[model samples]
Target: MMMLNIDDSGMARPYLRENIVFNHAHTEISTGTTLFACQFDGGVVIGADSRTSSGTYVVNRVTDKLTPLAKGIFCCRSGSAADTQKVADIVRYQLDFHRMQMDRDPTVLEAAVACRSICYAYRDDLTVGLFVAGWDESLGGQIYSIPLGGMLLRQPAVTGGSGSTYIYGYFDREFRSGMTKEECAKFVSTGVALAINRDGSSGGCVRLAIISKDGVERRLIKGDCVPRFSIC
Candidate 1:
């Protein structure tokens, strides 16, 4: 099977669009909705749609893709839910061990690197895309994108999953550095809302989290109310 490569647009090239063609187990690659993270003045905001699918069939409508790995640290999974959950568990254990060994909290960058190393080692066997976000005393807030094959990247804003292709333009036009937490929350919520409306693989509810100096705060944006954006 040919390894998948995500193009600049965040879409897998046509050859890899449906991982099903490569192998049966890889079918979960087509199940993504959208998961993204962005920086704000006070912290970072991470959001994801709740839909989980297998090909055209919806498997779960209330999946919480955004997971708290630790206090002030969160990860949003976008590919194979089982694979992502396994990796998240491994990374969470490592983070806890590191803190106990070193007597301090791990920084966002440290956690990303650790997670990437693990993902890279298992790249041939696992399919997963992740967005890591957190705040620390030294770095107020940050977000990282970790795609399959373990490409780790730091971005002010990033979107992953199938719905990402539909909403990239909205983020490109409205994103600005130094946005307040409130502004970032609204922007991310709106982006997920739009993605859910237009992308079949994306729907259900919008799960959001804000990671600040204190810790991570979570919220849920109802899917039924998202259509209001069509008028606004």
Candidate 2:
């Protein structure tokens, strides 16, 4: 009689256990769409569409993706709503604790590293993408894109989610060096609006966060605020 052995591939030489059991893995597919940020002359402009979807279903129409992770830093969440919120809370808590302990605020890069550490720890289990935008005394203003596993990329302009494919061209054509804060804000708003128009997964009102040397400003760009025609 020949002996059969099963390897890592789960294949047997001939006969395997008829009762072999396969473990089931639970996957929760939740995501949001259309988040982008850009740097202007003196500040950074971050914007996102307020749409949350679970697989094919629209879970919420009014969701805020842009959140303040630290006193001067803002982040946009794009995947797994619950995971995003929970990660944001964790990052915020860590930032707060760091500030309290050091008696100083964390720079956007430092904050990114901190958040990335947390994301790295859960790289295998969590699905989350983030963009960190803020003003730094040393670095001026910047935006850092954080993908799964906490890989961080400093970008002058970036977009995440399915809608990113549609808006990158628009952003490339409209974005330029040394744009004013207002110009950056308009560009972000228009890019998000265009995403909502084309990407079925992206819709609802546009939210904006302007982080500058002075402070951070939040506003909602309503329908009328979006230009009827291209503003570029």
Candidate 3:
């Protein structure tokens, strides 16, 4: 017969053996990420720090958290890596079919809506927070934040993940209403780098996706290349 144990949260979970002790700390895997997206004059820039962890152990130090959904649309993933990746994969497949049927590229809003739908549907079971950013003929550049509960938000700039808490103040002070492409990319990279430095679970290289009317540009900034930040 199977054994059921009531955890501290009062949830019943299956266990193999009565003698075995379960430690939630060692079993949970988390993507301690630093993800952000910002809009510029021509397009949008999305960036993330590359780190995946299980408890205190670093599982993947160089994992890419920025996933490309369509031609110009990309999502920065945080929370449970498996859940987020699966959501992205499902959304990408849907977008591809939508494009073929419509005979046109999917809009950024369409992609964001798809994400929100999936997230909201599985909100009770899934733990995911994503920043979807891209460029379309209609909107030029767009940024959307899909938080844990599947709340979709349209914003000029958005940040999330464990490291995000460290840089909220920085973004508030540094972010501007309008910025050039180069300026926006710099702002995103700097903010991610700062978060990587401050958050222990967030480290590794910084990955960026810059989408514009022209096309998408990918940039990888190594740890050494990251700009130094010091508070006096």
What does the lDDT come to for candidate 2? 0.84
Task: Rank the models by TM-score, top first.
Answer: 3, 1, 2
What TM-score, computed on C-alpha atoms, does each candidate reach?
Answer: 0.84, 0.83, 0.87
Residue-level lDDT of model 1, residues 63-132, one tens digit each, is: 9898877778888898777888888999999999999999999998988998799889999998888888
Question: On TM-score, who's better, 1 or 2?
Answer: 1
Better of 2 and 3 by TM-score: 3
Candidate 1 least-lDDT 10 residues? 16-25
Judge candidate 1 against the unseen true structure and give its global Cα lDDT, from 0 to 1: 0.85
Q: After superposition, how far is residue 227 of candidate 2 from its true place, in Å?
A: 5.2
Off by over 4 Å in 2: 1-29, 223-232
- Candidate 1: regions farther than 4 A off: 1-31, 228-232
Better lDDT candidate (2, 3): 3
lDDT of 3 by residue, 32-100 (tens): 799989999889999999989987778888999989999899988999988999999999999999999
What do the candidate models score in CA lDDT, each in turn?
0.85, 0.84, 0.91
Candidate 2 clashes between residue pairs 3 or more apart in a chain or in different chains = none
